[model samples]
Target: MVQFEAVLFDCDGVLVDSEPITNGVLRQMLGEAGWALSQAECERIFIGKAVRDERARIEQETGQPLTEAWMLAFYVRRDERLRAELKNVAGALEAVIAAHGHTAGRIACASGADKAKVVMQIQMAGMAPYFEDRIFSGHDLQRSKPAPDVYLVAAAHVGVPPARCLVIEDTATGAQAGLAAGATVWGYCPQGHGHAFQGLGVARVFEHMDALTAALNHKTSHGNLI
Candidate 1:
């Protein structure tokens, strides 16, 4: 059995099903600002990145400074759109509940989003109760995903060693963060990103949330090396 003490989850694509909505909004906003990226391109460039980092990249690429007021407005619009459109990823609640059952509540969220946004998304997706007070935001750290800071902090908060945590991630960047933190990372590749995740050295990739319990059970039964 893989000897994990905790399960850490990335919120956006993994649990909330908000990536398409958020990324679509981002694509529209950036297009209006003259970046004009397709939705797929926006996901490629921005998924699992911090908003500040994405904004900085936009500024650098366009040679146009995004004023603080403009950024604030952008966030407001994004949040409003998310509130209206976000839903839980298919089978996400059941998967989380199963994980919690196996780990005795040793589950937490380590997400790239800001804390407020994370909280709002989870609540909207009907997942707030499972992760209340156990959400760790990348915005809290100096460096976010792909840097390992947030994952390490999350493991610390949950009183688990990095090596004893299993992170559920969707994007390569988030998987990299878990790996860098010395955790076993599982990529949930429902969108057919399995090969991309394999390239990142994810321990396993599942294409559906319904497979989560079976995957964990298999690990527990086999004690497989991550």
Candidate 2:
């Protein structure tokens, strides 16, 4: 059986059910900025991407650069809305607790969001206790997900060798980062992106949180290090 020393999770879609809410806010903010996009379009474009990358893409596509002041305003508005609307993914907190129990609390969140946003979301979801002082944000790295830098840094911070870390991600970009970091990656495809994740080198895919828990238990029980 494969051994794992730590569990690294992607924050937005995996732990907190904030993708839909965040993407909705993004759509509105971009719409007001003269980029009218449907929710699906926003998700397709921005999900799992770092803010800098998204900003560059938007500027390229719209032929207009967003001002720093406007970007700050968007962040303020998004954070305000997320504070009012964010919720934990169903069964996600339970899975985290269980994973923590199994792994002896070697858990860390690595996300392609700013640290402030990550901390805010985790605290708002009541999951700050699980990841307190164990969070790694894209802003901490020169390159974010789909580039491997953040995950590699996260593995180092957790004191786990990349090969001995198990990364749980909910998007292709995040899964790719895990793989590139040399970790065994499990894609949580609750919204039915199983095929996409499969193509991204995920070792496994689970559509439900319970399935993920069971998989972790089975792996550790079969001589895999927790």
Candidate 3:
């Protein structure tokens, strides 16, 4: 059994399986600009980062400024192109909604996604109603993952103390954020990212989202510190 008053989730990997779609978006956009990005290159540079951070890396590599004007144009074009490919993280809707529905403490999602995109994805997945007013965008926080700002803000929104919360994260950065916030964290372990959290400080890690769900539910069901 786990002891916590609230649950917080990361959006991209934990709430939705949008990473590959995101990589595809980045790859296509970069490709059009004559920058040939292989799949490995996309994962290395873009995965697990806010778009702006990814853009910064792009700028660093390309040795040119990616202006606001350029970004605005790209967003406009990309949104239309990536619409049909949006998807949810496995057991995301089920896990968060189920826990929120049953537990006394509230459940919320903190995402690196921008607010507009957050609305679009969650609404498209029909997960908005579950979160309703409890959703938080990384833009709203002073810092993104690995800084604890987003998760801290979400915990505050849920009316719980950080120590009393459990965070679900898929990225090493997101898990770091939870740890920085002093929350108990469970990493949604992705294969091949072995030992990513071994020293970063997560309370637990699980390869299966179902396993994470079961653990959280087990803790809740047993009235053990939840």
Candidate 4:
């Protein structure tokens, strides 16, 4: 059995390779509404930001009403488009869930993605039942990633202490959040990472699920790899 009792995951870049597609959809949606956002602007002003923050920024930038109706419309459109293009991220669903059940560990998802959208994506990908009861969204916490709220909540919800929980994350913000919550944070740095996460006190860096499996196996010596 693995020594760790709980596993936590980030949703977007970690669970699904949907960041590029999500933003691409966003750019198209806003462009159709007559507001074309630059790439830098899309990344800088967005990326890991919660919907509330994004809506405020959008209204501020475009001098338009980023109202509830607009939010609903964008969400509906993204959901419609994303279900057809759901891309799995680097063995995320398979390896993570496999490790969880293989070792009797409780697996939870803590993500910067909003709650509704996270549910939609997970449901669409058929990964919901694996973690539905343990899902933790950024919108539920006062402070998002890099602040520790979401990860801490996840650890608590799954009945594990921060130290006994392992967080699998793919971004600096998410890794920092996990570490801040007092957990072992592993940075999953696959190819084409836009930002570097080398200096974030990550327990280890792995580019693939095989490396992650090896690291987890070495860390937990109680049993052989399953």
lDDT of 2 by residue, 49-133 (tens): 8656877778866678867887788789888888888888887887787778767888899999998999898888777887779
User: Per-residue lDDT for 1-226 in model 3, tens only?
Assistant: 6457888878777777777777777787777666788998887766666768776667766666778876777677656655867777666676776567555648888887777776677787788877887788777767776788888888988889999888888778888888899998887765635477778777676765656556656643221112
Better of 2 and 4 by lDDT: 2
**Best model per lDDT:** 1
* Model 1 misplaced stretches (Cα beyond 4 Å): 1-3, 217-226
Better of 1 and 4 by lDDT: 1
Question: Which ten-residue region of model 1 has the weakest summed lDDT?
Answer: 217-226
The true-versus-predicted C-alpha distance at residue 62 of model 4, in Å, is 0.6
Residue pairs whose backbone atoms clash in candidate 2: none
Per residue, candidate 4 scores C-alpha lDDT tens digits across 1-226 of: 3457787888887778888777877887777766798776776556666656666666766678778887788788788778878887756666666657744758888988888888777776668878867788888878987789999999888888999888888778788899999998777767745246666788766667665565455554221221
lDDT of each: 0.83, 0.81, 0.74, 0.75
Sum up the clashes in candidate 1. Answer: 2
Worst lDDT 10-window in candidate 2: 217-226
- TM-scores, all models, native as reference: 0.91, 0.91, 0.87, 0.84
State the lDDT at 208 in candidate 4. 70
* C-alpha lDDT of candidate 3 relative to the true structure: 0.74
* Candidate order (lDDT): 1, 2, 4, 3
Error of 3 at 27 (Å): 1.8
